[model samples]
Target: MTQEKLFASFLLDQTQGVEIALRAEQVTEATHIQGGIQKLPGSVDFLEGVMHLRDDVIPVINLKKRLGFTPDSYTQEAKVAVVSHFNTRYGLLFEDIKEVFRVKPEKILPINPALRTDDQAISALIKVEPGKRAVELLDLDHLFAGSNIDYTNEEPPHESTAKQRTYSRYVVFSSGGQEYGVSVEIAREITFCREINEIFRTGIVAGAIELRGRTIPIIDTQALFTNSETTELITDEHSRILILSAKNCSVGMIVDHIKEITTVADDSILPFPYSDNDNVKGMLSRLDGENTILLDVHNLLCNHVEAIKSMANIGNHKEQEHEDSDTGAHTVTHHLITENCYLIFSIGKNFAIEIKDVNEIIENDHVMRVPGASGCSTEVINLRGEVVPIINLRNFYQFDTKKKSETNKLIICSAHGQTVALEVDKIVTIYKQEQFYATPSLGNQLRSKKDTLDRLIEFLNDQEINEHVLVLNIHSLIRNHLQLETTSRQAADLHADQHADDTITEQAKG
Candidate 1:
């Protein structure tokens, strides 16, 4: 007997409705259409603009229009269903999303070849019991056949190129009754205002909050601009934290609430007449007759270095306590000044590598495919004058192969004087003042003997939560996993020279 399969049902139109169902496994999530949509030039007719979904910018397609039906007016119940096809995610705009239901094999009926048309989107139909309406199963592979919609390569306009002006999106919020805007590139995420642990109550530093595994200092924007002292922190339903990244560190700023994510033209911004504050970059005049103060995020974060350092100290202290309790091991306290830095990135999951092991980080561009090099690396890129091998981390880790997008990054790392590039999904962030711990017994047994993951590191995510990230042992990875020699001629000569120097110093002391 065949097992039943689940399907997510939706309506194309409410009045003259056409019910459709997509396989539940393909649908990632259904979310409200927020921040509206930004139309793209030279795009297909049915390709509705793009919308920001958490960390990704997805292209929304009007399902009604794509199916030769007029799109209905968007109402409060309208939603964008995020679906995955070929490991690439896209947003399907629908009038309304119905419930997910199961269809038994007996009720599933395939469409006849004689009745199918050239543009047949319905592969099968589910006959409901009694008098319920039949649901048409959607064939996503056929619907998006030969479609070439790329939304990830849009780049921001450069300041020097005045003729090629493009629209830049900004996340706008209110602070101290005045609205301010920050570029979407720097704005990490918007989260609810959590209770802050007051480590430093001076100036605009309201306190600190544990986000993921790291402690981030919360800056009171009202106090910063007003030149006033820190007041009693208050919270309400509308309060939010606008997490901003600068200098490879994240800091949360308290805002009244997130108003909207909108795009502003490059020429639309006017220089601020007042020069009292360097943080205020420009002014954006909106249609509602209000001027939004565009802020320089880098300057704002750089000004609060002291507060940021204090938050890092708090994180280290808490991490030490956690480690001691878990392993019953009392480790020596390490100061923040001497702490090591790491580059955090994601392949399928989060992983960390020491920053010192990295030579540089570059974009995954112009990679040439090589034949018969499929074991560890199958692609190489010309970095400077050297032909550097590109290791697909997903393939090496045995993760599902995903379609590479423009946002993918390449990390140039070296071990034993041999350099290679690691292809990753995206660079998450650079973490400082972090500690490394030994991998647990269970992890050691599960991992391969030649695997690179021998240690664990912890970091905080955007949602103020902490998780363990596996640290890559680059030396072992090169020697054991890649079967490369542990030492180059130059490295061996340097090691011998160091030993000779030590012996001569010992002879002099004797």
Candidate 2:
């Protein structure tokens, strides 16, 4: 049974000539700001940068930037709208959150033909609230790539038949003029770019992450952002890494500059798009000033790590060389765990992998709801980038939609040559090596056993390691929950306004 949860419901501005639906937690009431634009430095991705709420550094994003429209001014006179994801939280610097209203699912109508802007982007537009004005019903998920900062707040996850996410503490960074956040949990280490162990044919964005002795997967942040935008990288010599975990997943995010860490509430943020970008989870709460984005950890890892694992076959030759070295030839196979160990997460009856794999158990720190996510997702969380993907377990597994519960968490593990993140109802216990294994027979069945990885082997874990626990195939798992474009069909005349729906979504490649 696939479970579905209404993460949060929010209203967009009608004065903007569009009806937008915000994840319940996406909207927040601001206490200050009026007249006089505040020009803060950040990225095109966000409207501005980190701010302070009473004394805390609250991230503030601009709605104009998100809508692919230019604002007349970013003055302090603007209304501050606070948003939050399930685990992670953030705030939006809006013209007026008070303008936000509610619209019944049936009342939402796509933009008229006159509104058609792009032929490829924009799926559907809804009229929010029964008012004279209208706000664009935004597809926030497809719009914002998950934020970096973790939302789980470092709480342990629970064990259930569905997918779940925990929260954590994290840090945000600045690249070019944009502010990006990441969970301190998944971050492994920080350093400047001297020379990435570039491995050709290793996908579009990838290099190598150095662990104790092994060079794990290192995400190519430059490539990722470049693909997203046609902008250039403006960085300094001192680069930093927000390393969360290192297992079968990538080691860390190579950022331009490191920022300070902050705490947030998980109750207020919400999703943007009804369902779109798997990378972005939602936004955080507004604490007086500035709003930030909550990243989707799984989305980041999925794209970055996939470049290393899916696109490239680094270990094929490396392993063969290692075998030959045993025949008296000279060769150096780095690290103990050759392949990163990945953890298998099941939510809403769907499966996914933590970006990083782990050998030991770590606490998720805090557990809370993700704000600013879409109906497609249950919550937002902070893991890698301090913001990882927390699948709506209910949406995928049992069709259950229970909100705000104590038996949930963000589980971190090592495997699959990188770190993997997963949201869960609860976690059992970690198992030691030589006691678990992955078996091919275990496809997508739930291992009824809890407390140890061994029992999970019956279903969740494979017997590949015999007695050791085996991780599930994430590609298959993510595919289960995520809606894939099977044929790349261009949505014809999407704008209900007139021309098109403003063609907002730029896509990963665009």
By lDDT, the best candidate is: 1
Span of 10 residues, lowest total lDDT, candidate 2: 447-456
Off by over 4 Å in 1: 1-163, 230-232, 317-510
What C-alpha lDDT does candidate 2 achieve relative to the native structure?
A: 0.44
lDDT of 1: 0.73
What lDDT score belongs to each candidate, Candidate 1 first? 0.73, 0.44
Alpha-carbon TM-score of each model against the true structure: 0.38, 0.30
Could you tell me which 10 consecutive residues in candidate 1 have the lowest summed lDDT?
314-323
User: Candidate 1 clash total?
Assistant: 6
In candidate 1, which residue pairs get closer than 3 Å at backbone N, Cα or C atoms, i.e. clash?
Answer: 211-464, 212-464, 212-465, 212-466, 213-460, 213-466
**Model 2 spans > 4 angstroms off:** 1-167, 201-203, 209-211, 226-234, 285-289, 303-306, 310-510
Tell me the RMSD of model 1 versus the true structure.
22.7
* RMSD (Å) of each candidate, 1 decimal: 22.7, 26.5
Evaluate model 2: give its TM-score. Answer: 0.30
